[model samples]
Target: MRPRLSLPKPHRRGFLTAAAGLLGVSALGGCERFAASPTGRRALKAGEDANMFVQRLLLTPASLAKEFPDSQISPWFKPNGTIDPPDRAYKALAARSFEGFKLRVDGLVERPQDLSLADLRALPARTQTTRHDCVEGWSAIGKWTGVPLAEVLQRAGLKPNARYIVFHCADTMEYAAADENEEAETDKTANPDMEARPEGAENQASDSQAAGSEAPGAEAEEAQGTPIRYYESIDLTDAYHPQTILAYDLNGKALPVSNGAPLRLRVERQLGYKQTKYVMRVEVTEALKGIGEGGGGYWEDRGYEWYAGI
Candidate 1:
């Protein structure tokens, strides 16, 4: 049997405590309100940015996450967030086994371009066995193969002002109005767990209209109080890190829909949530304010830490 890998646990409890204390409440309502309030929002953001600064200042950007040998690979890597994106566009691409899937690279670039899976594969590839740590307190090691994100950023001609790389995904996990976060939904009690979706809620809702198990498509969009866009971002320091990759293969096989087929971001040093799935677009921006809730990530908007640096 393979040993279960885990990050050092000494600080996990302290981190959670400080996070809860910072938000003023452990209950969902208080946490949400505090995170959404202007003063609380600024506090959380400053704390997040400060944490990021400390991580970058203390650790070299190119430092690698510990790598394991092939024998240590997990027998079955648990699919992390938004198993099957049920978006119409995503379905169209998956039908052909992602033969025509194109990753869009835009914003703060001299050239905005879309590259197909073949195009991405043509670039230099790096493979590494790294442990994936989830916020729910679990870890698994898998060998991931992909082109470095820095290579793609270079190809896109990242402008000097590109401060952060935003990952825009296909899941409709939103608490805000469609198109943008202009309006808030009255229902905020659905997900107190901060999971990808409320367990089977999204699956059942989408399956009712979708083609049953044939699609394995998500139900977040159709489900009430679902999460939105499933987005995340990292500053240029982490974005350019050697281990930060756009992975298309996991454990020596083509990535699965449940595991973010076509491509997913793999920032080895951060928590698993920082590595988003069903990545349809990469948008470079000078700031995070325009994205959902302006808190840095989907979970961050709902009270999780933005800088989930582990």
Candidate 2:
């Protein structure tokens, strides 16, 4: 039998207070008239930048979170969004069980790399079992072990303009029609389905469709190939936090493919989505305004606050 571990009462209270305060701030920032106006937008950006800077300054660099005894580990750690990406490229990777998968680190860096699973495993690793809280109102406790993201960044030689870090993933949340159409056409030509397409045939069809939709102009944005895996970005302050890691192992073993096998971002302070899984590329940039509706992330563009600190 495992011991039932719980968070301290004061810590729980503090978490609630911070969440309420953040919600209030987001509510104020979301007012359309205020957020859309030039003056208001500038003011909001300034305020956000200032708040981030202050938080960075106050952060204790080496301070560690409390680690629990093994008996306290939760038995069931629930999987979050897009548990298995519907994207064909991701499915193919899953088929092989992700044995050949590699994580690429490029953009705004002096040294770009295509690191293999073995390469990542060789890096220094940290293990922690922390409580994961989601904005949708659920919580889970799990043990995660991985290399510190700061170490990976240091090895990459980030350029002076690198102020934000963007994570590109193999998973996607939505499937667009444009992507679907391309797949159908490719499948009809490549593999004729007399009775019905085989599972592999269907996947190939989907991949062809996804590939056909990429505009030539879109290709110029990054050297990487497309369907631009589900991506998210964060400012440098969060990027360098001690708790922010490129997790290669989870719960004391090689991470299962369903749990983002090769590498996953564990930005402990933010919401679950911000911790992107099956990360392929880590791009460091100076601004978020040019990335996806200029809000910060896919969810942030929809209405969720970018700074989901809790």
User: What are the lDDT scores of the predictions, listed in order?
Assistant: 0.74, 0.63
Which regions in candidate 2 have their CA more than 4 angstroms from the true location?
A: 1-58, 61-63, 176-228
lDDT of 2: 0.63
Candidate number of the best TM-score: 1
Best-fitting candidate, scored by lDDT: 1
- lDDT per residue (tens digit) for residues 1-310 in model 2: 1112222223444444455544555778457776677755555555544444444445554444455677777665555454445455555665566778878898888889888777877888778887777776767677899888887888888787677888877664433335434431212211111122222322232332422332223333222223334578876656777788898777786665445656789988777768777788888777887776677776777655677665
Candidate 1 structure quality by residue, lDDT tens digits, 1-310? 1112222323545555456555554444666667677866666765665566556657775788899999999877776556665465677777777887889999998889899999999999999999999988988899999999989988888776778899998765535555455675633322224435333332233322332333333465444334456789988877878899999999888887767778999999899889888899999998999798898888887778878888
Clashes of each: 4, 2
Model 1 TM: 0.75
How high a TM-score does candidate 2 get?
0.68
In model 1, where do residues sit more than 4 Å from their true spots?
1-47, 174-227
